[model samples]
Target: MNKKKIIANIVKVISWIFVLVFFYWAIKNNMLSHIYEEPDKFLRLLKQHVTIVFVSGLAAIFTAIPLGILLTRPKFRKGEWLFVNIANLGQTIPSLAILALAMGFLGIGIKAAIIALYVFSVLPILQNTIAGLDSVDKQTIDAARGMGFTPVQILWKIEMPQASFFIFAGIRTALVINIGTAALAYLIGGGGLGVWVFTGIQLFDNSFLLSGAIPITILAIAIDYLCRGLEYLVVPKGLRLARKTNG
Candidate 1:
């Protein structure tokens, strides 16, 4: 099997192990009892959590990718360093701190929490997009130019295809981190599965904690897997094979 396949299999095995452990722990401690008893409450928080992550993640993707593309262009190259450093600075700030800062400006709400998450997520996707496009072989681009391919054609057909994997990798990493960070949004009254998590903490109820926490873990993993599927469908077959061989 290829390196990619080997790595994927290993990840799958590891994910399953964690899932089984979560279930075993849940059963042993009755951590999921509250979820069964309060199905509506659990589902409501689940929906809220999903909404927060989805909105922020989507915003990050939309904003960062285009900005990354612009920064990579010859006209914008001079300003790239400044913008990149700014994005990197977002990563330096603690997640909770960012949320709190947003709260200070916007007041306590889902909107503030989402803005913070978007800020946090932008760096990875931006960095990856820039890196991906940069890593595309210069010779290949030049060859395309020599072949009379328009700048737009070269960008869409050649550059984007080569860069897509890295872009997706960034998105997956960002969204997973976002999921974990989102749990902290509860502290700011942003409301999510974090509500249950903090409720457990305050009340010392393990059931509430596990019920809220494990689903977040599962959601992050599911998102990572979904992005992988997108990579398979959106990235070209030739690119996939080439990356596997090179990887």
Candidate 2:
């Protein structure tokens, strides 16, 4: 393997090790005692927060993919630039401000926080998905057309397959960022790891902070590795060969 791949692999290994160590340390330090103290409340809190995360993640994808598809297409697909700009502006909006704004209607909780993370996560996935689809070989697209493929077929069968790696890369980036941002949600009374972190700070409990921080970091690393595997799986063999040759 090349030097870049070797280094990437080493970093991945170290990341997982760090996660394991941090999680163990948090457990040993009794950072998780609060959950055990009130199992029902703890379970409810975790479930609610996880639901928010999943919903936010999906929201990001929904807002992202349509814009991505439009922007990546060769011709203007009706308000393409407008859609792209709107998504771009979503990213530009500060998360704190968004959360506060959401609080006006949604109240302070997972709903508001999910809106914040969803907004933050949308741009990268959208931009990368568009870029990835656009990056596909033009000749390959032409060949598909010559084979009598419709626009829809070209998109699903040809474009998406080629774009999978970049799309997944965007997802990987979004996941890592969301894991960290999930902590911020605690300020608005959203659950998840952020609850511990924020509560720890307020109560002068380092263990609570560590408990939150460690799990988040581990989740981020795990998602990153999983994305890498998907990237490997979806990246076209021809592209890999070309990369190898160029390297």
Candidate 3:
């Protein structure tokens, strides 16, 4: 009923319309001819790509969130800058270079790709978790302490809940980045949609290129929307209402 809601609805409608149109164009032009010719291969590659993204994302989340929390604690605060800079270095390097390094040390396969993706995907989640925890209201923390809540209790009950939205935002970003970067896995003999893309380029076939490219684009967009919905669902209702009102 509100202006923002109306605009969001309109944007959603247009996005679906665009996807539908693109799909129709691809089908009409036989852009997926290569995919249809070997459905099994396409399916296998799709599964591999999704698996890499999912596994690497989980790795990043588990590693980064705990490290971020630890860095915020008094005993670990001094090392925060060191860890943050190391994470930042991961992002600063080219993804292809990371994959190459993985290939050099870990060999050419899923193991190497997973290691590279995990490293590349970690920084955003780590940074966001730290920022989210840091942004929690000091007054709220003080009040919790006054109520005799233990440090752990305050973190679990107050800090994490307040920071959940920001944390999820970071995750969403990491997911999108992972989806895009996972394409490079094919270069290291880690099967993914990149196989089709590179093959298309090597063969000079537009159909092969679109076959891979379109699906990656769709997957990223779909996951992005899914994460956006999850963010709304998981964030406290009061916080959601406040955000809407403030916006």
lDDT of each: 0.91, 0.79, 0.92
**What ranking emerges by lDDT with the best candidate at the front?**
3, 1, 2
TM-score of 2: 0.83
Clashing pairs in 1: none
Candidate 3 residue-wise lDDT, 15-44, digit = tens: 989889989999999999978898999999
What C-alpha lDDT, on a 0 to 100 scale, does residue 115 get in candidate 3?
90
Which order, best to worst by TM-score? 1, 3, 2
Which RMSD values do the candidates have, in order? 2.0, 2.9, 2.0
Best of the candidates, lDDT: 3
TM-score of each candidate? 0.93, 0.83, 0.92
Alpha-carbon runs more than 4 Å astray in model 2: 10-28, 35-39, 77-80, 226-247
